[model samples]
Target chain A: MHPQLQLLVALQDMTGMIKEVEEKGSELEGMGFKTAGLDDLKRAREELEGQIEPQLMGAFQRLTAKFGRAVVPVVGNHCTGCFAQIPSSFVSKTNAGKLQRCESCGRILYWP
Target chain B: MDIAEVLKNTSPELFLPDLKATDKESALSELVAGLTAGMDIKNPDTILQMLQSRESLGSTAVGPGIAFPHGRTLAVQRLTILMARSTAGVDFDSEDGEPTHLFFVLIAPPQDLGHQYIKSLATLIDTVQEASLREKLMAADDYEAFCAALRGE
Candidate 1:
């Protein structure tokens, strides 16, 4: 599948988790859970966000930025992406529209 | 092939072929439909249905003009991937208010290949983040041209 799009989805998930943690921290403050624990939680959230931001930004940059345009096409029983050996049978099947995977890389392949 | 070498071969033959769309679904449906068919999917309905089911769980539209819809299987054969470009673009309930022109669909088989799958996905993600590449693809007027531009030729 397109990797850039996948990364974006993953970033969204991380963002949601961060939001939940923030909410929990606020709730603890309201209920007087523990100052030290709440502080720790907030710190953890910041770290996570910092890490997530660069990755997500990079992913978005690639996707919207056009980094993966040259996705290879499988040709002559070889994976164009990984150049891995695809069985002759699998290659034929993929051509026949039955679906085939590269033995090495495992990405579903199609004839160019 | 070494991962680096394989990664370097960005020709249309590696991706952007074998996708057959019988009919156009909605914007999201188009993305799902294109990917399922592109992979020569085994159970197209299964993945399609799962994506539909996900809206009930929560929106797959993760914002930023991107959406991630995935499904599980007790006995999947292998992971399959599908990518598509909608020239006209579509609205996916994104936060950026930008029309989605690019899409990636992932189908994982029921095996312990999760780590490998993630690796392949990461590579794909890296590719998508290139700004110059995106411009070329957007300029493509047809599928053939699109494929060529994707290859950077």
Candidate 2:
């Protein structure tokens, strides 16, 4: 994976964690797990986002707002985000292929 | 898509009754090492990194002695749950300030953002809250007993 894409993946994971905790706080509390430091998690997401370039991060943010996952894996030449077929040209062994967006969902695509 | 699916995917190898790790990193390493085969991507390191990044945000330790260390990543093809009992206990920096005896690592593909992923976690959390379940798990000498205990039998 490209280092930038890798960083984006990390940021998305962080964002997902925070969102789940917020969305599931009551259920988590029912099981006795403390849902604290969510703000700290947001801070961590910001810190991670700072590492990515503005242009890429802007696209990421826009796509994530439209669709829950900004970055998605390409499985069997199909975008897992929207299940659209990714063209063969974009699917390559090179790291740059992972940094491209799915023409269908516009979600960033990467090979798992 | 359901707990049965999660159960269907698991075997005795994924359940450890005697984990040797004394810290979170080693415990995760041990669990990830045991679960590498489940990752379709064949990248256990990426799975481990995903787990660690989630932990870095906050300890997933919920109750007295159980921790639900979970995350989503491209490494896994489905909702993967690998559980272990740290006989010596591991410090996961729990909010309760107690040693975690039960460790349940939940990792899945990013596409399972809703429904199946969250439901699986909820089911696991509900199952572990039973005191009888914990007692039986601690006494389980093998996978069958551990599973039975998990089922509240």
The model with the greatest DockQ is 2
lDDT per model vs. reference: 0.45, 0.76
> Model 1 off-target regions past 4 Å?
A1-112, B1-25, B35-42, B54-68, B74-76, B141-153
Highest-scoring model, TM-score:
2
Worst 10 residues of 1 chain A by lDDT: A28-37
> A45-101, model 2: which lDDT tens digit per residue?
788888999999999999888887788877888988889999887855553434688
Measured with C-alpha atoms, the lDDT of residue A37 in candidate 1 is: 34
Docking class of 1: incorrect
Query: Candidate 2 - CAPRI tier?
Result: acceptable
Q: TM-score of every model?
A: 0.42, 0.83
Candidate 2: tens digits of C-alpha lDDT, residues B28-133: 8888887865434555767777777677656788767888887787667677778788889998888878899987777777667465656777777767777877
Query: Which stretches in model 2 have alpha-carbon errors above 4 Å?
Result: A89-91, A94-98, A103-105, B1-6, B43-46, B130-132
